[model samples]
Every structure is written in C-alpha cells, then in structure tokens.
Target: MDYALKESSTKFETILGTALKVPGVRVDREQFLLQTLGSKIKDGNIVNLAIETDPVTAGIPIDKLDKIANSLIKKRTTNTSMLSFAAGMPGGVTMAATIPADTLQFFGTAIKLAQELVYLYGYGEIGNANQLDEDIRRELTLYLGVMLGVEKSAAALRVLSTNISKQVVKRTSRRALSKTTLYPIVKKIGAIVGVKVTKASFAKNVSKAVPIVGGIVSGGTSYLSMKHMGHRLSETLSESIYYTDADYEKDFKEVCNEVVDVEFN
Candidate 1:
C-alpha cells in the first residue's frame, strides 16, 4: 500500500483511541500498565495504542478542537444515562465489571486520536448518517488517492468502512438487536452508489452487496451518530487537558501528538 504510513497511523489510532477515550486523571494507572509493566488484554498484544500524524495538518485547529472536545464531554455524560437503562447490568457490579478503569484511559486516548483525525479530516454533521458516510468515503478517497495512492485508497476505504461499520453496529445494536434488517436496504442503496463509483472489476459485486449493506447502514446510522458523538467527546476532553481554550480549558499534563510512522511486523 502506497499510503503505508497513513494506513499504519490510522490503525494505530483506532487501537490507541480506545485507550485515550478516558479522562487524563484516570489514564495514569493504565498508562503505567501499558508503558511500564506493559499490560496485555484479550490476546498477548499489549492493550496500548501507537499513533502518528503530520503536525501541520493532522491536529485540528485549536478553536475547532475545543468545540469538538467540549461536545465529547457532553456526550460522555449523556452516554452515562444509557447505563441506567442497561438491562445487561445487575447494578454497581455491571458498571464495575463492564466499565473497566482502563476504559477511562482508552476514552482519553480516543479523544486525542479524534483530534488528529478531525484535524486531518474535518468534522461533519452527526445528524446526517448519509452525509457522514459520504464524508468519510470522500475523505478516504482523497487522502488515499492524493496523498497515499491507489492501493492505499482501497485499503484506507476498507479500513474506514470497517471502522465506521463497527460503530454502526455498536450504536444500533444497543437499541435494537437486529440491525440485519437493514442489510437488504443498504445493499440496494449500495448498488445505486456503486454503479456510479465502482470500477468494472469490483462493480458487480459492489452493486449486489451495497443496497443490502446501505439499508442496514441507514438503519444503524443513528447509533453511529452517537458513537461519533462519543468520539467527539473523547477528543474534546483530551484537548481540554492540553490547550487552555477558555471554552474548554482544563488543568492537566499535556501530551503532544507523537509520530509513529513505521510498519507493524
């Protein structure tokens, strides 16, 4: 992939953002686990993120970053409400068991990662699912084609699609168990869009698959919007810890965006 650096960075952030989604104060313990003792999660892989982005274009401007960060804080507070209705949990035990201390750490990391991504790719309306999809696809295409190259574009799109799709599943599944109901619809819509955008080699498959996918995408988008809102919250909180924007200023140790532009073995 020509955009090997960019792809590597994207994956890095996705993994890392999960860690960074927490508040700074909470990150200390997990940071120690990740960086010092080197904690490993489900697999042998250390549950830490390594991310890199261009300083000039990768970090959103301070004002916009502040707006984004603040929004995320609000969303986190709101997401807490979901816990009230969480049938899955018995009580304090569920929150304690399901919501790990490390989640806060990941939340903080997720925020910083969002900052870099929003900096590189502008934020879009959370209300409009189609718009979000288009925005993501457009950005991925440009970033891959212009900055990275063809192979990278495909890879980036796949990654972006997969990531967004995961969010869609996460968000929507919370409300309704069967997002599969949307598959046929998304697949049809996907065909319409695919016919125009897809190249010959992959066009037929895309045409067949997209509407079913697109429909599910449409239905699941509400949750995706919430996830984006959560992401925005994470970013906002992380930035507040760093930059002293009057709108979102906070007292904490600032972490600079570190660049890690190497291929993972």
Candidate 2:
C-alpha cells in the first residue's frame, strides 16, 4: 500500500476501534438489524423481505430510506446527547476527552444506519468486522466516504457500479481497487471523513461547555448532526446502482461468486 493509503487505513481503524469502545454505542437495535440481515443473506431471502416490507424499496429509493434513517437517528439522539452531557461534566469542567465518547456514539449510530440502509438497498450483508471480506469492506468504506460527502469517492462509486454492471469478477475488481492509481482517492476519502468526524466532535464539545443551557444545546446539535449524516448516507446509498435487485444479484454472483437465490414476492 502507498504511504498515504497505509496512514489513512491506520487512522480509520483507530477511529473505528475508539467508536466501538463507547458504551451504549452498540445498541440492541443495531445488533438485531445486523443479525436479521445476516440471516436473510444466509437464507437468500433478501428479495422477499424487501418486497414484503416495502415494494418501493425493491429499488431502495433515497426518500424512503431517508425517512427510515431520520426516524432511527431521532430515536437515539436524545439519549446519546444526555449521556454525552453527563460524561463531559466532570467537576464542572467539560473534559475534552468526553468529546470522543460523544462522537463515538454518533459514529456508531451513523455506521449502523449506513449498514442498514446499504443492506436494504441490496448490497447484501456487511458481516461482522472479523467476517467482512476485503471487497465488502472496501465497499463499506466507499459508502462511508459517500456519507461524508467525498466527491471523489462518489465518482469512484459510479465507476465501480458501472464495472459491476459489466459483471466484473472479484479478482479483477480487487486488482483495480488495489492499484496505486486508486490509492490516492481512497486516502483522500479517509482523510476527509476523519477530519469531518473530528471537527464535529470538537463542535459538540464546545457546545457542551456552555453554562446553564449547555446540555440542551449539545443535545440539539447532536440530534441535527446525526440526522444529517444518516440522511447523507441514505441518499447516496439508496440511489446507488447496487440498490436494485437485478444489479445486486448480478454483482453478488459475479463479483463475490456466491449463488444467492433471490425470492421475489
């Protein structure tokens, strides 16, 4: 790997590790969703599930996923915000360390939302951290970059989608992805997303330091920011080529070389 790509990968791992360590970050809802989706993938029941749940989601429309993402974020933000405020209030001093904790909550929520939306859009199960294949992992990273509004990642995703549509296999795709030509873009994406997360965390810390109404302000800020990130992910991922059943099945069979029986009901 290039130096920049290696550095960005390290930063990504560190940030993800920190986020996973936060209490209440891995909520039951997220676990349930993942497990359910994983089971669906294993059983090859995704298409039926999509049709039974929402016919429109067969294409994974951005607006529909956006609504779901908004609901998910709204449901969790209040509790996370309060917890963040309490964590920061140490001897009447808002410790900077608490910022990471608060940000981790948001990161966890954002990641969960991203995964759920991507799965619903027909990207298949993003398995557990240890179980994720390199292709799927890279796809998730690309989605994260999209969630962070990285234009280069977005453009790359489009190209990737085109390639998948052409039935690119895993080896060929991996080779292209591993090329130095793409390393710079991937590195840039990681840097941009990392900076955005850091900046957001800092702003939350500043808002939480207010005297009387700090908690309220922090809560509001967290709510809006989390919702914004969730919507961003939903918008980008839902509209992706991978959202359609046909496209997803094609990619899954060709790229992953797995026979996924898609049941349309």
RMSD, one per candidate, in order? 21.6, 10.1
Report residue 61 deviation for candidate 2 (angstroms). Answer: 7.7
Local accuracy of candidate 2 as per-residue lDDT tens digits, 34-54: 454444344335445553443
Deviation of model 1 at 110, angstroms = 9.2
Best by TM-score: 2
Choose the strongest candidate by lDDT.
2
Which pairs of residues clash in candidate 2, taking residues 3 or more apart in a chain or in different chains?
A: none
Q: Model 2, residue 66: what's the lDDT?
A: 54
State TM-scores per candidate. Answer: 0.20, 0.60
lDDT to native, each model:
0.30, 0.52
Model 2 ranges off by over 4 Å: 1-12, 21-70, 76-79, 91-99, 128-138, 160-181, 241-265
Q: For residues 150-221, could you state the per-residue lDDT of candidate 1 as single tens digits?
A: 222222222232223111112222222122432222222222222322232132223324555432332243
- Deviation from native of the Cα of residue 90 in model 1, angstroms: 5.5
